[model samples]
Target: MSTGQATLPLLNTTLENCRMVIIGVDPHKDVLVAVAVDGNGRQLALRDAPARPRGYKTLLAWTAQFEQRLWAVEDVRHVAGGFVRCLLAAGESVVWVPTQMSSDYRKKVRASGKSDPIDALACARAALAEDLPAAVPDTEARNVKMLLDHREDLVGEMVRMCSRLRWHLHDIDPDFAATIPKHKLHRPKWNKSVQEFLARQAGSVAVAICVELIGRIQELAQRAAQLEREIAALVVIHVPQLLALEGCGPLSAARILAETGDVRRFTSAAAYAMHTGTAPIPASSGNTHRVRLNRGGNRRLNAAIHRIAITQKRMHEPARTYLDNRRAKGNSNTEAIRALKRHLARRVYALLKNGPDHAQADTTVQAA
Candidate 1:
């Protein structure tokens, strides 16, 4: 490939004097392609290595020629996580380049086609032109995220199995199916009853299938419960203050902690709110001021916050009063809930930043 000039302008004299080199990596399952560029965004070197420890060592040694270096890696966690951990463990400075930003950069610089080298160069240039978040080690948040995801998967599987089991039960004995509640199929009491009933029924393909599904559903429920306990313990250790807030349960708190991933990465509470999709977007016209709902940012985090807001609206006195005030001011129910979510974002950010001890004094939602 030609060593073409980058579309971005050259760095200022200060950065140029520092001679910092940005090494962008495009990681794949087996191999990684890397491109090294200087302050001027001119590609200086290119290399490919295995996506393993030996390959990481090779890249480290190869890049050592440049005294000042920063690794700009694509933000694909599954592919780049191990490489990033390796780099951080070696005391290397690194930052994540969002895939969209790099892809856009690639379009602007390259006329046609795409390759790993092109993508890697785009990552280097994108990092050079933008202020991206510095990469940090996968800490407690990673563990919470993994556990929460596994539990959700198990729950989803159980739901599907329960649905199938319901159909089978109705086929075998509609009267008995009506006796058992539609939603109680996964409960131990109901499952035991189901086992006893199935034992009495004459053996058939449908009966056999129902027996198998019930056993699987029971196992999945047990495993999901175990994961929830583990997650709750982690939440207790990391952000107990979050749980102290009304309507913020262990599962909700876990989602917030997992998605936020170090609230310090955000400059302030407003930034955190923006990331949660709770911050209102400006949609004003001339001589008119108005804000609209934001539909961007991490939707899963937004959903968690929305769940808390809904719970608070239903039960918490201060939250109810706050919603009443918003409604009195001509805000609709949806608008009131959005405002509440924004407020919750600020409180959540504070709790995560200050931990339990410092956050003990202000756990309740103040009427604002």
Candidate 2:
């Protein structure tokens, strides 16, 4: 392929600099494995540096050594936040490649491919070869991402504990949840108030078991609520506009911001949709095909967009009306929601991509 043909303008300056370094990171307990490689994808050095203080220092030193114009690292979603922060703090330009992409490359090239060193080398090669798109580095958004990641971790823990608690309660008392309505399982008030009744049961074994299970579940639920409140507070502090959307609550808004990073990186709404996996695939092959969903992009982003679509179907006028119209025209529920999601993603992309007159444009569209 020609160098300038498929190349985006974003690659111009970096390619000119040519002294690129790709750092493959395997973040362990106290240390992270960092393999630094030159632009030609040759390994330069390896380090077992501290995850927090020492790792960052090593990274800074390495950055100074290369004087590299561009840096690339594997994108590990929530896990790579700290590493990315360290790189950004040093004012280094960073790009992100998904682990799967790098792993597949390694497997294809090298027959034996299951070590940290090899993986690190693969990461370097991926960056040098343009195997993945360069990510928009956003330090401010990283702070927001930290909060979302913390909240997600707490929520996941709470969910697991809740499930275990339910099982323990069921084993002790078969009809424990029978007193409350089935749909109220997710409600904290129901869990809290009903626990008193369980605790007051005549049998001691049932009472003891119920007390233990309820106590654990209650604690988990409380923790989950605290995380929720913290997330809301952070959104209010940093990402206020995201919460302004009709169906976007604090959590969802934070998630969208965290996932998309710098929205301006997307050249157009279509680009944004394609990155988020909301864009329909081009399926024409000499007039032999229809469009289908592209599975090439971020799954989490797609899920987030799907959630936004579902939320808007109930709360936002345009979304709801559009879905209704689609369904009335004989589209299935899934199809209608997908159509709504594509439109919603475009709207979100527009709001983020456009400058100064976003509100006015949104209002004009609303009126029309």
**How do the predictions measure up, each by TM-score?**
0.80, 0.73
Candidate 1 versus the native: TM-score?
0.80
Assess candidate 2 and give its lDDT.
0.65
lDDT of 2 at 25: 63
- Number of the predicted model whose TM-score against the real structure is largest: 1
All models, RMSD in angstroms: 7.2, 6.2
lDDT of 1 by residue, 60-103 (tens): 99999999888999878788899999998998878777677788
Candidate 1 accuracy as lDDT = 0.86
List the lowest-lDDT window of 10 residues for candidate 1.
Answer: 5-14
Considering every candidate listed, which one attains the maximal lDDT? Answer: 1
How large an RMSD does model 2 have? 6.2
